[model samples]
Target: MNSPTMHLPHDDHDCGWYGALPSPAPAKRLSGQQQADYAVIGAGFAGLAAARRLAEQKPGARIVLIDAQRVGYGASGRNSGFVIDLPHKMALEHPDPAHKQRLLGLNRAAIDQLQGLVQQHQIDCQWSHAGKYQGAVGPRGLAYLEHFERLMTELGEPFRSVEGDELANVIGTRHYSRAVYTPGCYLMQPAALVRGLADSLPKNVELLEQSPILGLKRDSKGQWLLQGSDGQVRTPSLLLGTSIFTQEFGYLRSRLLPVMTFASWTRPLSQAEMVAIGIQPDWGLTPADHAGTTVRMTQDNRLIIRNTYKHVPRYGKSVNEATREEIRAGHRKALLARYPQLAGVPFTHTWGGVYAISRNFTNFFGELETGVYATACDNGVGAAWGTISGALLADLAVGAESRHLQDIQAVTGMPSRNPPEPLLGLGVRTRIRMAAWNSRSEL
Candidate 1:
């Protein structure tokens, strides 16, 4: 059987935020037989967190972490860095008071951990506690915001509702009729943050990049032998943090749905253009409509627009140049709809990132097969959810116990099974199209 691997499209590109940073030293590929006490596949947020926690717990044990690409080249880096501290859209749907509180606490814990790390290590990813705005474009979106306010009120979370001139003051865009300003989300340069985290991993953890795994099986001694393109690793314990590709491991195959989302970043805006745009220097806006576009004005004045979701069952193998161009055109239209003043503002980069969604919108977190543990399917809250889940998974691996771990396990018991293949694909595509249509104004 072919070893599961993550394949990034050759034509996919990153924004200037990533390209402007200095490259890390060249990757050291795995080329020979190696052994480790624990192994982590995928060096994104979750994998990095798992490796770090494991290394800290087992000071003398060898921990191997591998990624198909560079540390920050995947979804971890490609995301529009929003480290949310509250349960946003998905959590709002199933609002069991206790469960929501548990999730909120977990998310805040993740943010605290991340904040401490950034302060201690001085990981300069343009980290900011600038909060975020959930903007509404029409009556439907307004009703959604009203429901969000009710939930927030029940949870006693602080939020400010802004509209008309107040909304313009917050985002400088009159496109939104109203908005809810919540002060808990942190914004950052995603690629830089992931790179810093990877670089700061403990000494005992070995990081191998650009080495995709080809196969994985249990040896006669009950150890896992993971075969890579040019090498193999034998470990008694393994953690699968490989994002949407975790399906390839035969773990959450029936429950994991891979969705690819596109993002476009414009070139830095001139001082005059910034004035003309009439928005805050740096702001992040999530649409009140869950399916709507997400917008961010970077610290450096670049506009980041993310929208257009595709049901990419096989990651990007089926994503052609035409599809990419179509996505770009959609992004441009969305950008224009919100900020027509910045007409003709060219996007410097356009890229696609894969995120896993489950049938129940919960994560898959538990032991899959004997010594193999799987933790993924974050719905859409990748940054905070991935971090906390990884840390808790590490705690589980070492036989440690904590209330946080219990909360996570309780919340993400198991993913519900997905529909069979062709039907699953059809259903997901139809849902996405319908959602995009419903959120056209917000987009």
Candidate 2:
């Protein structure tokens, strides 16, 4: 087979999480020739963690972390910033108690590491242990909430059930009929957190933004040769945190499904508007149903509404103006349905992000070939899972062992193969549409 060239991430629209922040310093693009003991691609949570861990483990070695765009301008910065500590409903209800425990352990470990970094570096991303609320609108959503409650009880996890006036008092929204509050999740400004992570890298690690690898091949010495537009990097070991884009690098082509989800953020509300809604302290809520919307009142007093999914197999390169407008319309409708009082409040920014999911909902981690490693297919919880997986990938590469590494390995697996293209696209679209329709009330 011929060497595979990379198809880089295109910035279709501005990410609100990134745009809301002050402009960053000019990006340091790759130039001339470069050599590193280790090269990590994709500057998201996974890549950042992997590169940092490698530098920490091998303090005297050179490590390079490269990104196609500015750090945090891609999916990592575009996510709905929830650092979840517990498994989601599906994993929580797994038949094997040990499997559930391992997942929980991995997630919490990710959070703990991030917390230490935030404090040590004094990164001001508004990191908060604000917990999370799962809200329900109608019967279907309520049923999901009930199931979640049962799982929490079975696991002896502490949670509170709130409804009626209590629910409204908590989130300042009456759209949800009931909610379950779990006090383990943390919320933050994703873009800021990711950028901080990149900036705070150890002295031995070099961060090169806007330096997409245009082509890749193996050299006579069995080292990876990465060709950028303006330069080349030769490294003995290469790590990929590129997520679905890993397919373009000649790996995981048939095992990962790339899906795009959209989000919109409102301009900061005026003090009067805040009073009008009887706003409480900042909070975040996810729908009980998988297809339902995610809502957040940020610490900065802006509202975010994220929902709707599309099977953009082209990895968002084909997302046209029509689809963008349609998603914005959906966001507007959802916002009004929940807060009719805030009608006419305009959305300051709207954008879409792509995430990869495996057929069996497992992550892809470990070595792809000699001197090459990857962690991808995060299945929607990349913030926490991606961080720990990246760190452990470095540990695995260095032949290090620990309880955290073992836990991540136990839960990680090779992504199951997806159906061929046309069939895969059809199946995914059908399932997503049916799910959205079923959860229409929650949306």
TM-score of each: 0.96, 0.98
Model 2's TM-score against the true structure: 0.98
Off by over 4 Å in 2: 1-6
Kindly give the stretch of ten consecutive residues in candidate 1 with the minimal lDDT sum.
2-11
> lDDT by residue for model 1 over 263-361, one digit each (tens)?
998988898888776677678999888888899988888898899899886676668889888988898988888888878779988888888988888
Per-residue lDDT of model 2, residues 1-443, tens digit only = 12244456875666889998889999888889899999999999999999999999999999999999999999998888899988876788789888888998898989999999999998888899999999999999999999998899888889999898988876777888899999999999999999999889999999999988887789999889998999999998999999988988888888988888899999998888888897765788999998999999898889999999988777767688898999999999999998898887999999889889888888888999999999999888889988999999999988899999888888888899988878998999999999998889889
Local distance difference test values of all predictions, in order = 0.86, 0.89
lDDT of 2: 0.89
By how many angstroms RMSD does model 1 differ from the true structure?
1.7
Best candidate, TM-score: 2
